[model samples]
Target: MEAKKRTKIIDVLGSTSVGTQVLVKGWVRTFRNNQFIALNDGSTINNIQGVVDFTTTDEKILKRITTGACISITGEVVESKGKGQSVEIKVDQLEILGDADADKYPLQPKRHSLEFLREIAHLRVRTNTFSAIYRMRHAMIFAVHKFFTEKGFFNIHTPIITGSDAEGAGEMFKVTNLDLENLPKTVEGHIDFKEDFFGKETNLTVSGQLEVETACMALSEVYTFGPTFRAENSNTSRHLAEFWMIEPEMAFYDINDNMDLAEEFLKYLTNYALDNCKDDLEFLNNRAVEEDKQKPQQERAEMTLLERLKFVVENDFVRLTYTEAIDILKNSKPNKKKKFQYLINEWGADLQSEHERYLVEKHFKKPVILCDYPKDIKAFYMRLNEDGKTVAAMDVLFPGIGEIIGGAQREERYDVLKGKIEKMGIPEEDLWWYMDLRKFGSAPHSGFGLGFERLMLFVTGMGNIRDVIPFPRTPDNAEF
Candidate 1:
């Protein structure tokens, strides 16, 4: 005789087939009234109620079925008498595969703070909030691949370690295999990088945009999704030591075309979350409302989660140049009243979060695409405009998450790109291969980078960027 197959709790709870015997496996969410048990397998937000005949079951076995305990049950599916759920299981056999000590388990049946959960990140995924968030994250990832695949974009895997700084930010985590205690020094007392692992110098990649651009020159359209590292010492909620980035390069795309793709990409992801992860989104929406209630009236969001998502999908993003945005900010009430932390009084000053939010949420009441930023503030790879001051750079600012996407029409002319690189003081020898791309059959190309964690924060309505990422690598915090 063969054994019956195990059914996921999501399937059994969703099915209407009564009187069917099914094998279910999951962790106990709650054992209520000693007769009912709420079980979940991380499949869906809803849990299946397991009716246990406590009179027949041993007292010792029932005691072990506390919160976070793993269990397997053979039961008959029946119409649920509970109000919250439609179907439940009447248990015939209960087996405790693993027991979570009630005294030792940190995650009891209660609403824990997000900060507390971050401390116990190893076990946080079992909670409803994180479970829903991670599921939504998965859905968004699938939607990203789906959207690109449908548009005939090749998914390229870029290297994790590189010998060049693509962003030229000078904030990379150095990768070396040398005796640091007994250092290798030059005649001038400077560290000799020639003896390093890569023979000169290498570090964890800050961006795959450069490598992916080389791929696009051949594949026409390609994207890279991978981890990127930064060695900044900031401890803010928005900053991370390591993060994931999604960079897409198009061979013949101009700045306008790049803006179109970025807007469509964001809208597609938001709509995907609404359509595929409705149950989770609803729970998160209610959670966000409750969280906002604890804040001051002015700080609370005006629109609900679903409304915000719909707003992005339904409306066209406001398009303007850096000069125009600066004008609006300079004349705005915040600037006149000295309310802005960094006053937007000049044309070349970089826009801060407050300014971006004001433009997107208050001024236009939608997403905004700010373009043609001063070349000094942007990267060297961006196309230098004829004005000689600004580059063809664009930033897609969302309602809450400012600068969700950053990109530009790449500088394809060999002389222009080489001149910009030299002016920026980047090592010409390190990027000789990149210069070769321009020297060869390089077409007019453009690309953008989307911070995966920031997108997650926007979609999940999470306050902190740390909360969205599973294992956040923040300054002074790397707990498992």
Candidate 2:
């Protein structure tokens, strides 16, 4: 009688009955002298150790097998002697599916710099660090959907291309089809946008908050999880030209409620990743954080994935008004050199990244929710507070990652919004549809935009934004 083929190594390990025959297919991560093969089935971060005795295996065929070679194996579960984990597989039969050239393949056993790995973005996912990061990213995405879906929020798809600029920062990647040779031009040789794709002009969306507000007015609670593009020329670890943003808009909500929701959502996501992607997170903690000693102790805590997550989930996030934060910064230790970073003492100046990082990582020592930013520094749609000079906007700052969430209570009063738009010199005609929301039956609504990549960065302990995303799009680098 023929021996029955079994399930994957992952499933076999979970079963009570050891020594069960199994058929597993995976790429060879490492191979040793026709005696053993370390294979990964992509089922989990843990690779199943396969022991193949050379006496039974063909030496000629074993010579052809190399790292990264695809193969299928019929094996029996056995105890592992290796340091990786408890389980291993004793191979009964091995079949090489495809050969991988040891010299030509870019990935080697030695560590490669992230910069070099980025150049070969197509193959980086196969690496342990990137593989773990991408898996955690997938888990994080699902967790986001689950969190919003359970809360009765509607998932709305906002347009990628829009006629009106979302952020009004004038940093947009233009979309046009006017050929240079046959372009429509005015008498002075300036290109005319009248003949362009949208008849006027259009560009990729910077945020979906505006459109999400429109949907929230109808659905009462709506969110947009989509790709947002910005043409800003910032070359930093925190900035990306094209990235994902999660904009959740709620009707009849205040800034406080918005902050609460942002805090809850983040806690949920971190918990979800901790619960669902334990192995991957462990791999990241051991492999990624171990190399960087500068990583904070709170970030490096070895609490079982869930424990680390529960720390944030169960605890109340620290809250500080922008005014209070400014006061704290002013009263910080009497170091003259450190004071230079806080030079913009007065209100209205945009909070710099360094200030944000210091506030969360140093002052708060936990996730900090900073609210009531200066109206002049905030977006036009934010609701003005009773103070008259500040707006009801908030940013949630995490320890390693700064400003994971930026949100505000929107201006619901038509007159106030119109006046603000006019004062900002924005053409009212362009925002007619947005104004309509207030004109009809606008109630006080609030929302926030969470940078998805930054969240991934926090979860994976990845320092650079480019390292988290599969294919990073930057000013000069857009390679696949």
Weakest 10 consecutive residues, lDDT, candidate 1? 1-10
lDDT of 1: 0.91
How accurate locally, in lDDT, is each candidate? 0.91, 0.82
Tens-digit per-residue lDDT, 1-480, candidate 2: 224654665675566255667788888888876777878766676677888888877988788667888888876778778786688878888888888898898887678989999999998887888888888888888888999999999999999988888778999998888897898988889788998988888889999888888889989999999999989898888889999999999998998999989998998888788778877888877665456455676555443333435556777889989998887766666223565454655555677776776776567666789999889888899998888899999998866556788999999999989999999999999999999999998899999998999888878877789999999999888887
Tens digit per residue, CA lDDT, model 1, 287-328: 999988999998899888878889899999999999999999
lDDT of 2: 0.82
TM-score, structure 2 vs. true: 0.93
TM-score of every model? 0.98, 0.93
Worst 10 residues of 2 by lDDT: 299-308
